[model samples]
Target chain A: MTTVEKIKPLVLIVDDNSTNIDLLVNTLKKDYRLGVAKNGQKALDYTEKHLPDLILLDIMMPGMNGYEVCGRLKTATRTKDIPVIFITAMTETAHKTRAFEAGALDYITKPFHTAEVKARVKTHLSLKKAREHEIYIASKIQKTLLLGQPPRDINGIQIAQLTIPSQKVDGDFYDFFKINNQCFDLVVGDVMGKGIPAALLGAAIKSHFLRVLNELIRLTDKKEFPDPEKIISSVHSSMIDQLEDIETFVTLCYARFDMAKYLLSFVDCGHMRTIHFHADSNRCSLLRGVNMPLGFPEQEPFKQTLVSFQPGDLFVFYSDGLTEAKNQDGVLYGEKRLVDFVQKNAIMESKELINIIRKDVVAFSQSDIFDDDLTCVLVGIEKKSTSQALSDKAKLEIKNDLTELARVRDFVRNFCEGIPGFPLDNNRINLIELAVTEVTANIIKHAYGEHTGERIQINALLLDDKIVLQFYDWGKAFDPKSVPLPVFDGSQSGGFGLHIISHTVDEVVYSRDKKGRNCASLEIKL
Target chain B: MKLSTEKIGEVTVVTVLTEVLDASNAEEFKTATAPILKESNKVVFEISQIKFMDSSGCGTLLSFLRQLKSSNGNLKLCRVQEPVRILFELVRIDRIIEIFDTKEEAIKSFKMGI
Candidate 1:
C-alpha cells in the first residue's frame, strides 16, 4: 500500500549496535512506521512523547539497561500497556528468564527469526484491542442501568429524578419500591469512592436492599409496609462486616411515604439532609437525620423523622454531587442556591421544576458533564382530588339552575364542617348557604340568561383562618366594581341581590381568569 | 311557622316557636306575622327558639321593623341565641335593631323608651 493511502502501525526499535538495528528495521519497515532509540533513556523518552504499538529492545546497553527501562515503563500508568520484546546475543535460558522477569512480552535470540517476531507482535496487538472492545460494551451496559425509565407519578406523589454520572459508570444509585397503593419506599446512595470498585459496590448494595425488602414483604402475614429505619438498620448490620474488610462505607437516605396519612418517614445514614417546601405557608425547612454512615461502628441508632406533608408540598432529596457542583470559576452550587430555586419554583409541577434546576446547573457549571455523579430526586404531593374532597379545598361543577344551588350549598357546608373554631353551627351554615345561593341565583339570571344547560364551578379553600370560595363560570362576565351597591332604604326592589351577598361575606373579588372565564370569589373569616 | 303572642302592657311579645327561619319558610313567616305588627304599634320579637336564620329571614324582620318605625313605633328582638346573634353582627343588621337576652328586658327597653 502507498504511504498516503494507508495508515501504518508504529514500532520503536532500540539497540546500541547499528548492525542489529538495521536488521530489525529492514524486516519491520515495510509493515510498520519505525522509530529508532539507540539507548534505554531515548527509548523511554520516545515512548513518553508518542506511544507506539510495539517496542523492540536490546537487553545489553551502555546506560540504563533494557531490563531497567522495561521495569520503569510498566510502573507508569501512561506507558504500562505498550508491548515490549527483548533481543540479546545470549541464548542461555537464565538470560532469557531474566529478560522475562523485567516485564518483557517475549525475548528474541541473536539469530533473529522474522516470522516469530511478526507473529508475536500481531498476537499481542489483537489481544489488547479485544480487551478495549470489551470495556466499551461494559460501559454501555452500565449506562443503560443508570438511565432506566422511572415512573413519573407514584400514587398521589409526583416524582422527578436526574442523574448525570461523571464517568462511563458511576458510584451513585437511586431506586423506588412500591409497597402498596398508598405507600412506597425510595432510596438514594453514594458509595465511599468512585470508579469500577465503587460502581460494583453500589450495585451490590442496591440488589441486596431490594431482595431484603421483598423478603420482608413476603414473610409478613399482615399487610404492612417495611419501615425505613428497620430496613436501613438491617442492611447496615448485614453489610457491616463485608464493608469493613474492604475499608469502605456507603452514605444513603431511605424514605417511605404514606399517602393516606400524608406522612413521610425517613432515615439519613450520613447522607445530606432532605429539604421540605411547604406550599401552605410558602416556607422551606430541612429535615435532618442523626446516624453514622453504614459500615461504621454504630454510634447511634438509625432514627427516622416523621413529617406531615400536605398537598402541594415538595420534598427534595439530593446527593453531594449537586451541592459540590462547581462552575467554570470553581464556585460551588451550594445549599442556598438550591433552596432559593425551589422556593421560586414550588408552584411548578415536579418534572418541570426539576428540569429548570437541571438546566440552570448545566448553564452555571458551563458543562454538560459533571465532575461527580449529579443525582436528585424530587417528590411532590399533587393537589388533592376536589370531588368527594374534604381537605383544605372542595370543587364542584353544576348546571346553572336554581335547583343546583342547594347542592352547592351542601358542598360548601360539608367543606366547612371540620374547620376548627369556624362557623359550622346551624345559623352560620344557613347564613353562608344563603349568601352562596344568592350569588348563584344572580349568575343564573344575569350571566347565563336562560341557557340553564351551562355550568358553573365552585372551589372552596380554607386559608389564614378564612374560608375562601372561588366561583368559575364560562358565561358572559361582568365587573362587580361597576355594579353600584343597592339602596336599602326600602325603596329599591331588585338590586338587593348583590347587596346581600357582598355584605354577608368578609371580602368579594371579581376578575377574568387566564382562560377568559369569570372568577367571582368570596372569603368569610372564622 | 308557629307563633305565640302575649300582651305585656303596651308592647305585644310575639314568640317564634320554629327553630329555623330561612328561605324555605321566611315568606310564610312574613305572611303569618303580618297581623301581629298591625295589632300593636310597639312590638317585641322573642327569638329564643331561633337556632338558624338566613338573609331572607333577616329581610322579614327588616320589613316588620320598617313598618313599625314609619308609625313612630319600634321593633325589638329578645332572647337572641348566640348563633343568630353572630349572623346579625356579620351582616351589620344588629346595628339597626335592639337585641336583649330576655323577653322582660326587650319589653322594658320599649316601655322605658330611654
Candidate 2:
C-alpha cells in the first residue's frame, strides 16, 4: 500500500512452483515490492501492466519457458533495460552460461538465500543507475554544445546559419562582425571530418578568429592597423599548430569590406567559390583562388584580391554543403543549381534569400535531415536613390542662351552644397568648372550654334563616396578615343579644352546612344 | 602575449611574442632580431606568440634561418601558433625546419645538429 515513489524497487517472480514463489515473495518483501506469476506468459503480462526494476525467472516453467520470456522482454525497448536474473536448479556451468546469454544480468540457484538474492539485485540496479547517469550527463553536454543562435542583422546585411550535424555536433562555423563604419569582416570554414573531434577543432578555430579580430580591433582603435594578410596568415598558423595532433585541417575564406570605399578584399584557403553580383549590370562573377587548406605541412602563400562594388550589388559566400547536397535519386544539388537559385532569389532580402535556399535544398533532398551541414551568407549593398544623389532644385539644365555662365556658377555652388563633406581642393574645383564650361561651350559653339531646337541634359549622381557627372546630348556621335592627341604647344588656346577634360577627371567613358546621340560619363573618386 | 624561455648549452630559447606578423612590420622585426642570429647560429625561436603569419614574414624568417644553417649551426622554431604553423606546413618548412613546442625540447633538438 506504499506510494509508488516511496515503494522499494519492484521485483517480478515467475515460477511454476507455488512454494518457491511464496518463499521468494516472503524473502524479498522487506526490501522490494514483489509480483508473482505462475508462467512466462503471465510474467510478461504482469511486466507490461506494472513495470518492475528487476525480474527473477524460473527456467522450467510450463507453457513458455524463462528463456523465451527473457528474450521477449529484452526485445521490447520499453522493458529492455530492466535487469533479469534466472533461478535454476541446474548447477552446470554451461546451463548458467546459457541463462546469462539469455539476457539475464545474473543467475541464482533454485533454493536462493535471502541475503544472496538481495545482494545480486542491489548490485545490478546500482550498475544500471550509474550507466543511466552517464547517459544523462552526455546528453546535457551535447545539448549545450550544439545550441547556436542566429547572427544579428547589422546595417542592411542579415545573416543566418545552420550546422546540421550527422552526429552530436558539426565541424562548420561562421562569423560576421563589423570592423568600422564602412568595413566588416566575414569568415566561414569547415574542418576536415565531422562529429566531436571536428567540432572541437572548429571551436578552436572560432576562438582563434575571435582573438585575431580582437587584436585587429585594438590595432584599429590605436590607429595602427596591421596588414590583414599577416593577420590571416598568423591565424592560419595558429590553427594549424592547434590542430596538428588531429591529422585534420580547415578550409577558410576571409573577406573584409569597406562600404565607403566600395571595395572588398578576400583570401581563399582552398574554400569554395565566392560570388559577386553587379546589380547595375546584372552580371555575376565567381572568385576562384586557391591556397592550401589549413594544417598542411607546406606554407602556401595567401593572396588577397580587391573588388569594387557599387550599391545594390550582392556578395554571396557559402560552404560546399549547399552545392554538395544530394537529392532523393542521388543527384547532387550542384553549383549550377545554387547559382540558379541565387539568381532567382536575388531580389529577396538576405534573410529571405537564405530561407529560400534552405527550403529548396530541403525539398530537393526530400528529407528534413541534411546529409551535410548547410551554411550560406549573403551581403547586400543597399542602393541610394537618385533623389538622395543631389537635390532636384539644385539640378541645372544647360540652355542655348549666350549669357548662362552665371546660371552654371550657381549650379556648381548648389551642387557642392547638396553633397555632404565635399572635399574639393581649389585647383580641382577650378579644373571641374573649367571642364564643364569648355564642354558646354563646345556643344553650344560647334553642335547647337545654329540649331537652338536641340536640347541637352546633364545629370549628376552623388554616390556613397564619389560623384559621377554624366552629360547626355542629342548631338551627333563623336568618339573621344578617335580624337587626335591635341598637340599642346605651350598653351595653345583653342584645342586644349578636350585635353583638360581628360586629365582633370579620374575616368571618362564615352558611349553612343541608341538614337545616335552622344553620352559622356565621368567618375570622380572621393 | 605569453613569454617564457629556456636555455640549453649556451643556446637561448626565446619564445616569439605576437599572434601574426605581416608585411607591415615583419621586415623591421627581422632586422631587429638579426643580432640574435649573429650571436648564435644555434638559436631556437620558440614561436608561440605568432598565431598567423603571411608569406613575406615567413620568407623573411626562412631566409634568416637559412643563413644560420649555412654556418654549420641552425635556427629552430618551436611551439608555432596554428595559423602561422599552417604556412610552414604548406611550404613544407617543417621538413627542413626543426620545430618543438617546449624550450627544453627544442634545445634538445640542437644536440644532433651538424
Candidate 3:
C-alpha cells in the first residue's frame, strides 16, 4: 500500500536440480519475486493459484517433462499468456524444437548463462506490458473517437447503431460530428487491411476527416454545413498518394443530416450501398454511388446526392464485413437476406429492430469472431413533416365525470399506437396518461361542476415533434392562469390538479373557440 | 378499492388492492381506508399494488395524515411503488409522510414514535 513497497514481477522456476534452482533464484530474486516447484505436477499446482509473469521451466523430471508441463500451461486461458522458457541439459536441436512446440517462448540450455536468462525475462515482461498498454489505448481511442453519442432529440430522425471493434481493432470506424443546430454529420469508414498498421491508419484517416471539415468550415459560411462532397473529395485527394504508397484503400460513406429540412446528403466512396426501406409501401431500395475507393488509381471527383425522407422510412448503412460474413457452409450472408429482414422489421423501434438484425448476423455467422469490425448504423424517420398531418384526427367523446377518466387514457393509447410510426416510448406514454388524467379531472370538477350528464369530447392532433390534445366542453370556460401553483408542501389542495397538468405536459392553453366552447389544449412533445 | 387490513400490535396495515390511485380512484381509496383509520390510530398503508399516482392521489394521502395528526395519531406508508414514490418526492410529500420500504419498517416507525 505504501510507496516503499515496490511490487516486483513474479517468476516461477521449475527445475529438479538444486544447483540450477539456486542459480535461477539468485539471478531472478533481485528483479522478480520467485516461486519454486521441484516437479512438473508441483509446477502445475503452484501455477493454479499464483499467476507468475514468466515461467522458467525445466525440460526433464521424474513424472513429467518440461515440454508436457509447458504444454499444460499453454492450454489454460488463465496462464496462456505467461512466457515460458525451457531449461534443458539436452542441447540437441530436436529437444529445443520440442520445447517450442510445447509453447516455450525461448530456451536457456543448461550450464545456464545468467546474463542471457536475465535479458530474455526482462524483454518478455516488457513485451507483455506493452501489449496490455496498447490494448488499453486502443479501447480509449475507440470510445472517444470511433463511437459517439448520436443526437436523439433531432426531430424526424431515430438512429440506432451497433459497432463492435474487435480486440485488435482493425480499421473499422464510425463517427458523428454536429455541424450546426440544424445539421450534423455521420461518417463510417473501413481501412482495407488488418492489425496495428491498419488500425493506426484508420484512426489517422478519421481525424483527417475532422481536419478537412474544419478547413472547409473556415472557407464557407458558418451557418451552412461543409459540403459532404467537398469533404470526401479533399480526404481522397490528400490521402490517395500515401494510401497507394502503402498499398491500402479506404472505403467511406460520409453522410450529412439536415435536421431542419429532413434531408440526408451523402458522399459514398466505394462503400457498400446504403439500404433505404419504405415502411409505407414495404419496399427496400439500395442507394449507391459510382466513385472509387479513396486510394484507387482512377480517382474520380466525389459526387454528393441529396435525398428527402418521409415518416415511416428507414435507412441502414453497413460495412462489407456484414454482407461478406461467411457461415460454416462458406456462403456469404449477402444483401438479399438483410434487405428482406429489414423490410419486415422496419416498423419496429430502432433499438429493437437493430438488435434483431445484429442477432441474425451473429447467428448466421455461427461465431462471434470476425475478420473485421462488425458495424451498422440504422436511421428511422420518426416524425411526420411539419406541414402535414400524421394521420386522421383521433377524437373520443365521454361523459363529463370522474369515472370516465379511464376511457380518456385508452383513447390516448389507441391514438398513439394506431399511428404508422409512433416514436413515443413507454415513459412518454405514462406522462401523457397522467397529464390527460389531471386535465380531464379538472374539466369534470370545475367546468362541468355537478353536471355529470354532460359529455366531453377530446381530440388528438399529431405533429412533427409533439402531440396536441384538445378537450372541448360547453360548460364555463376554465382559466389555467387563474389557478395558482400548487404548494408543494401540501398546504393548498385546490391547485394540485392544475400543477400536475402544467408540469407533466410541455404546454397547456385554454381558449374559447367560435361557438363559445371551451377548448383546453395540451401539447406533449415526444 | 379492495382494502384488506391486518392488525400488528396497535398498528394497522391496510393494503390497497388496486394498480392506479389517480384522480379516478382517489375518492374511492379515501372512502375505503376511512374505516381502517377509525379503527387504528397508527396505520401503515401497504401501497405496493398502487403502481400509478398523480398529484390528486398524493393529495388524498396528505389529507389523511392531517386527519390522523389532529387526533394525536400518525400515518405511515410502506411498499410504495417506484412511480408513486417519485410523485411523492416530486411534491415534497415524502418529507411530510413516513415512507418505508417494507410494512415491518413502517410499523416499527409507528412504535418508535418519531
Candidate 4:
C-alpha cells in the first residue's frame, strides 16, 4: 500500500444497484474505509453526518439522480471540497462535461478500472493531507512563538502579564531583567503585524534586547558603558537592516532604575506614555515626547529621560495594547482613562496596583476577549530606614548654625528625591526651607536665648509618601504640645509661624534625641 | 487622503498628492501606497508644492520606507523643496530616507530591482 493508503482515506459510495455497490466496495475497501448508500437521499444523509474524503456516485440512481445529488453536494460549502468521481454508463462528452460541471473530479465508465479509481483517489486525498499538515505546522510554530516566559521578580518591582492573541499568535512582548545590584531594566514592545511573521520578528527583537543588555552590563562593569542613545541607535540600524519589512516595526520602551541613586532613566521609542505618580502630592505625570518606533534606520539619536523617585511613588509602564483596548461600544480605554485609573489607585501596594489595573482593563473592555496582549509593570519605591522622632527644645540647638541648616536642607532634598509618590515640586521645596527657618528661629528665641556656642542637628527621613523631619539641639527642654495652639485669626502674621508649619505639613511630633536634648520633629507629605 | 500617481515605468511610480497628511489622514495614504511600494523597489515622493508635513506626516513616509526595507525593498524621495527638505535635514532623516534629484533617475536606477 502507498503512504496515502496507509492513512486510510474514508470514501462514501452511492449507487442504486446492489451489484454495483458491492463491486465498488470490493475495489475500494482494501485501500480506503468505505461507506455505502443505496440512494441519493441516503448518500446526502451519510455525507452530512460523516464527512468522507471522496465520493463515488452512480449516475443512474433511482430517486434524486446522481447529477442532482452531485449538484447539491457541490453547492454546500462543507461538502464542496470533497472530490467526487462519477461512475456511469453514459459515455458522451457532454455527459462528462455535465458531471465535471457538477463538481466531479473524474468520470469512470460502467466498466471501471480499479487502478484508475485508486490513482485518482490517492492523488486528491494526499494533496488534501499535505495542505492540512502545512496549516497545522504553521499554527503550531505561531503558538510556540507566543508562549513567552512570564516575568520573574527582579528587585522590588512586581510584574505580572497576560497575553491573548487575536489570531494564531501576537507580537506584543514585555520583559524584565536585573542589570546589577542597584539597577533593574523593564522592556515592553509590540511588533507591527500579527501571525507567525510578526511573532518571529518580536522574538528577534526580544533576543536583541537580551544581547544588548548583556553587552551593556559587561561594558558598565568594565567602566566602558556605551551611551544608551548609541546602543539603541545601533540596534535600530541593525534591526532595520535585518528585518527589512515595512509591515514589521517595534515600538519599545526601555527603562533602567537605579535603587542606590533612586533615579530612573528611560528611552521611549514611539510607545504609549509611561505614567508616574507622586504619592505625597496625590498627583500624576506622563513621560511623553519620544522618538519614532525602532527599526526606522533614519531615526535620530534617542535620549533617555531621568526621574527621581521617593518611597511610595509609583511608575507604570505599559504597551499600547492596554490604552488602545476597546470596549464593546468601540470606545478605546484611552490614555486619559488609564491616567485617571492610575491616579485613583496609585496609593495601592505594588501587587494590588497591578491587580486593580488588570481588573479595570477587563471591566472597561467589558469582555473576556482582549483584542491585544495586555502587560503592565508597577514599580514601588520602599522606605529605606525608620528613625526616632525628636523633641522641640533639641530642635533649637540643632538650628543654631547656618552650616547645620544647610546640611539639614540637603539631607531633606536627598531623602525626598529617593521616595516614590513624593512630589519634589517647588512648593514643597520652599515649604521645607520655610518650615526649617521658622522652627529653628522659634527654638533659638524661646529655648537657646540666641547662644552662638550651641550646636543643633536635624534629620529627615521618608516613610512612604510622608517625610518625617526631626530637629535636635543642645538647649533648654521645651514641649510644642504644651505651647498654645496658635489661634489662626486669618489676619495674624507673626504668631502664625508655628501654626503655618503645623498645617503646612501632614503631621508633627515632639520628643528627645539620644543625648536628652529637646527635639521637635515634623512629618510632611512631599 | 487621495492618491493620484503616474507610473514612470515598470520600476518607479511618482505620487502627486494633496490631503491632510497629519496623523488623522495618514492612514489612508499609508494603506493605499504601501502595497505598491512592496511590489517595486524605487518610489520617488514628489513634495515640491506640498502644503504641510507634520511629525505624523513625516512619520508616515518613514514608516513606509522602513516597511519596504524590511521586505528588502527600497524607497527614495525626489523634487522636495528646501523648506520640506529642511524638515528631513533637521531630524537628520536624510540618513534614513534617501532623496533623489528627479523621478526619471529614480525609475531608471530600478532597471534591475533590488
Predictions in order: chain A TM-score: 0.52, 0.50, 0.54, 0.49
Sorted on DockQ, best first, the list reads 3, 1, 2, 4
lDDT of 2 by residue, B1-114 (tens): 333445567686766666545433455667767767777778888777674454345556667766776776777787876555655554456666677877778787777654
Worst 10 residues of 4 chain A by lDDT: A386-395
Question: Candidates' lDDT values, in order?
Answer: 0.78, 0.68, 0.80, 0.67
TM-score attained by chain A of model 1: 0.52
State in Å the error of residue A119, model 3: 3.7
DockQ per model, Cα? 0.10, 0.01, 0.27, 0.01
Query: lDDT tens digits, residues A140-198, model 2?
Result: 43344423343353333445444444322346777765664446778777777766666
Pairs that collide in candidate 3 are: none
- Candidate with more favorable, higher lDDT: 1 or 3: 3
Query: Which residue window of length 10 is worst by lDDT in model 3 chain A?
Result: A383-392
Per-residue lDDT of candidate 3, residues A176-219 (tens digit) = 88775446788888888765677778888987888998898889
Could you tell me which residue pairs clash in candidate 1? none
Which portions of model 1 miss their true places by more than 4 Å? Answer: A1-153, A219-221, A384-526, B1-114
Candidate 3 TM-score over all chains jointly: 0.47
Clashes of each: 0, 33, 0, 33
Can you write out model 1's per-residue Cα lDDT over A361-393, one digit (the tens) per residue? 888787676767888999988764422244676
Ranking by TM-score: 3, 1, 2, 4
By lDDT, who's the top model here?
3
